[model samples]
Target: MRKSMPEQNTVPTSHEVGSFFRQSETSLFAIILICGGLLAGLAFLDSGQHGLSLVGLGVALGITFMGFQYGFASGWRRFLQIGDGSAVSLHFILAALCALVFIPVTASGLGPSGSLAPVSVSLFVGAFIFGVGMQLANGCGSGVLFSFGGGSGRMIVALPFFVMGSVIGSVILPTFLTFGSLDPIEIGASLDLSGKLGLNLLLLLGAAGLFFWLGRRQGFGLTKRMLGATILIAVLCWAVFMVSRHPWGVTFGFTLWGAKIANLIGLPIEQTTFWNWPGPQRALTHSVLSDTSSLMDFAMIVGAGLWASLSGAFGKADWPDGAQLFAAAIGGLLMGIGARLGFGCNIGAFLAGTASGSMHGWIWFVMAMAGSVLGIRLRARFGF
Candidate 1:
């Protein structure tokens, strides 16, 4: 006689989970595809800076989609059979890969950092503080956006406080600047790469090797359906990154949005340094950051999350108790203070810095990790 298998013992396949969301995510994906096609077509027709090669852009988007989901599963979601370290490990590798390629690109006058040399002190400090804040608030700027979009009540409160903190920090920036030396990192001047293209090619190879090794060691084990979800996220992130000409900075977008609404209502929102203070006298600080694409990107991310939640397919996360809220508010304020002092957030400083080969990014990571550990411990004390 054959042994009978128990129904409950069977694991739910990744395919099933993916199939459930196929209708929702796929429809959204189609919209994205259409919009991307239109944008590329226009860019091609105009022959301007905005007119990037559709094929190249598509490839980059594919890589990004794969990379983000891979990390998300391996790190945050812990979906893969790997431990917690897997996600962060991949992130650092990618960041380093980005820096290797980007440093040379910056040298060639084609990247974001104007003077790209070594990382600056401001960048490191900003990244460190931003990391701590992300852990405290339970998400990065981008994390918050998506979480909120997915119908997180706690994130609703958190997002507002974050904007308010940034605004206040911006207002007090002049006083802070008086105590600092604002200088650019002249990486182009200091770095001595023999050939930019050759270095970039090497970097690309290294990144490919890393992905293959990681995949082999810890297979996604996701069915084709689950893989589709991963792909969708990665593609979205890559497209946003390329179009912005900068790494994704979700917090800035939200902050800018808050400032815009306030200004529209005739509030003295612009009077605050947070919204309109100058940057090192080298740049004018106004509502220039309040743009269409960044804001739309932020909105869409949240919307996607919300759709996930409403369908009851997403996790049921909740708001923190009074103690947790206090910590979040304080953490948000500290993050704002740090971001102002350091000159960016996690996305702008840590991720961008690491990608650009700035030493500051490493320092920020160390400090932020310390902060996260402390915050998590504190949260645990409250029984959260």
Candidate 2:
């Protein structure tokens, strides 16, 4: 009787098999898109037709979108839930890691925000305004691009205004610079320590640990999947640096795009001090696809869109009410001005700046957070 025990079912259920295939297909498709996109961008760069590089940039963004989807779908959503600071903490950690690895190994220079400006009155004011704008728009610089790619209707509305605001900010940037800014400060350069890099690594680790503890206390405990996603994102950031020969940037492209449009419409944008710079001048005179930042920005939006559509994450386009629209416009304006005055937005200033070990990045983070609190309060009035 004991030998007559029922046989166990060893085979996987049909549903399990189907799920496996779906996941495999998704992963394979993402890989193909990423590889193809990177190749296309490189080819364009080699051909010296930088303006057409958007095709490649879009593909790269698609990869990033897939990464985000993976993170969100894989128990990482908790860190992104409202009121959780884990996302910001993760950003800082990734930046520090980037600095540690890329700077020493690849000899990567500091991020765009590495050249710090003095702690002037405009710095505080601009950061505060940028923070408020980010909350109201429900997106920062990268956030907006990714959100738009991910089928967020609101972001579509916010994107153009963001561009316009950036242009305006660029136009007025000279005024802000003249407002008594101290010379830019670089932490690693200024320090006299024998092992400056080692000290930076230690400090960054301490900050990451502090943020992790704080996030856990706030009920946003880190998960294994989130850690994996962070590692992947770090790799992507490194790749970007290797390819672009500069750390990742977003808003500078926005400013350039805006300036180009202005110039097309008979605005003497070239006369401005900001645009008179060699880099800005070159970008202005060339095709948009030639600008790495703009190309990447465009690609990110397309990639996000593809991901959102495939993943069923795309939201329907719902028009906002008058108050919400007003808020969006104002928010875009503030973010534009704030980013220019503060030397960069969250991505450029906080993430990239911190990764580069710039003191200004830390300053931007503190002021922006303060602004976010107020922005949140204001956002509620607009029924967000």
Candidate 3:
């Protein structure tokens, strides 16, 4: 594994630009060609700029995520173990920044649709399970993507099962709906733009403040590098919404990927109520490149792969023991299933959900945090 650094958020005092380019020429060229070809192919299809633009944004996302080693799963674990809230505070900061833009832009009808979801029975149960799974697998949706991209053998094994779990969840999602759910509740649905923005800012900043207090021993501020990464992510995620007219999402793409594979294996996915929906049917018929989340997912992988090469950190992780492997498998399944039943993962339901003014986002955070506590307790049993 790559060696750990002493400090993650320190700002440099002077310009010390050493050799930053560590990636090989072959890798650099291959990524360029692949990106260029995808853009060109999109142009050939006469697809709008959204499809092609996502390819670039996706890469940028992967690079930032990998370069910073921003592990949502690990962040929670750190908080539980040592009361370190630096990472958790950073998360709140990111969400607040997004809310500053998202509330206004979406209110004006000039940007993407909100990442809303019903506050439901499934949401509660699903998010809790996902929390436990993320800890066991040691990755969330974005975590697994970059981890696998950086050549983690354990994550590679978990990836396929994640897809399988997504498909299974999708099949049962409608059934879960019948168990009773409330309509999605926006934080300030009745308020005007300025009013909602003010309220959301108050809440989000308050969250950041709470974490800051809990992590007092570690200090409340971010490293200079991490600060930059957080801003870049906020900008890139907003860009995704601007280009696609939909908020950033991760887990559903996994669901779609799984469904396609299931159909091939004679699962009769086409006969399912969820797949037969107009939107899903269109997505199923079209090539994966045409799916916004899928394209971004693929690009994130490439981006992470490129970062690993540049950082010279790829192929450093040793394979896991049998118990860890088993945990990864079960964890993958739980995350996939949780994302489907819960209506999103950390990225989808929590970050984007809160940013887009969905109240379910807060519900997700509470329940998942509880689940994480349990996951931590079970880690020893799993030989983690």
Candidate 4:
């Protein structure tokens, strides 16, 4: 029999904290230490080969920092419960921190190579669908991976379905593209920053002010632990933006896993973009999204999940009933399709978009929230 909530709380004294840590998904501090050290070592060894691509360096920093931030957030549940606004406040603080760093870097137009690529309307539409999918799944792509790591049995089922959906999505993406749903955002035309620092300065100040004002209005105060976590995540976000050549992503893992699974099953899955056929051998070839760094993302989620599960921070399995299961499956499918269509997920759209100053991010966020609300309503009505 499961212990009652009251019973569990009353019997906690000597080994409570230790036990909780043990049950948590993964040790953020440990991940920070390990990953940070690895990246640092790489930076040390290849000072000449790669100048520690600031964006890549930033991403590494962001991942570890976010682990700490989430750890702190989850630890202070009592404080967080004090006000719903508290969560908003923390996001504001984190967002502001990210915007300040990322905006300036992008505006500066300094990087290893590659000209600036514009954010597009397609990105916005994709983002909106992605957001809606996150709410429906009751977690973002990254959240699902961690939830599974933390022993979320329901998420475990959802993950595979998510991959399948992505494969299906890849097959049908051509149709969507033909229908004109997948267009890119034009940056060069819309932006008016010509003078050296004109646009960059405006964006930097705008991002900082916007997040700060939002935070103030939302009452973004924090306990020491949460403060520490926030700082860690802020730094990490900065690093990710500087490194990964794009943004922090979580769905790529699902995409790759899905591709691999399909190939194994002889389902004619793309060895590259999840849309092509693999004949004779399922040999993985070089594409922008399937390289070492892509695999690194896969490892991070698995690693984080492992850490969370061992720490006793794992939530209950809470398997969805038949109806809820159906919802979950469909939701996961939408998420996969939407994420691919948008070229990202919650982390990709909202988190990355907000940090990058793309207006599409904001649009996707609103639509996704709306979709989530609808999903919740549907779930409730059906008792799922």
Top model by lDDT, which number?
3
User: What TM-scores do the predictions have?
Assistant: 0.62, 0.79, 0.89, 0.64
What local lDDT does model 4 show for residue 15?
49
Model 2 misplacement above 4 A: 1-58, 65-83, 105-119, 190-194, 315-320
TM-score, predicted candidate 4 vs. hidden true structure: 0.64
RMSD of 4: 8.2
Model 3 stretches with alpha carbons more than 4 Å out: 1-48, 218-221
Q: lDDT per residue, candidate 4, 1-384, as tens digits?
A: 996765444433324434454554355446644664565455445442233453244344334433453521122222223333444445545655665666556666786111122244444455555545554555567666655544455566667777877666666554455544423342233555353234433553454455445445657544677666767767766655555555666665566666667767897665434344451123243332233234445445545544454444444334455555565666677788777666666566655665565555555555665555555555564354
Q: What does candidate 1's lDDT look like per residue over 1-384, in tens digits?
A: 999976683533445434444545655445645654554455455444443433234334333332232322114323122423434545544554455445554556664431122334444455556556665666655455555554445556667777776656556655555555445443233436644434433543464455446655665332455445444543443454555555544445445655566667787866665444453211123332234233443444434443453444344445456666666666566676566555555555555655665545545555666555555555565455
lDDT of 1 at 259: 57
196, model 3: CA deviation in Å? 0.7
Residue-level lDDT of model 2, residues 1-384, one tens digit each, is 467769986644445534453555455447646754664666476455443444555455555645464321112123333545566566667777777655464333344223345666667777777888888887788777777665454666778888888888878777877877776666667554436567667767777777777777877755677666777777766766655666677888889888988888998989988888888888898877677777777777667655654664443324466677677777777788788878778777777777766677778877887787777778879987
Better of 2 and 4 by lDDT: 2
> Per-residue error at 260 for model 4, in Å?
2.5
lDDT of each: 0.49, 0.68, 0.82, 0.52
Per-residue CA lDDT of model 3 for 87-130, tens digit only, reads 88888889988887777887788746778899999999899999
Give the CA lDDT, 0 to 100, for residue 94 in model 2: 78
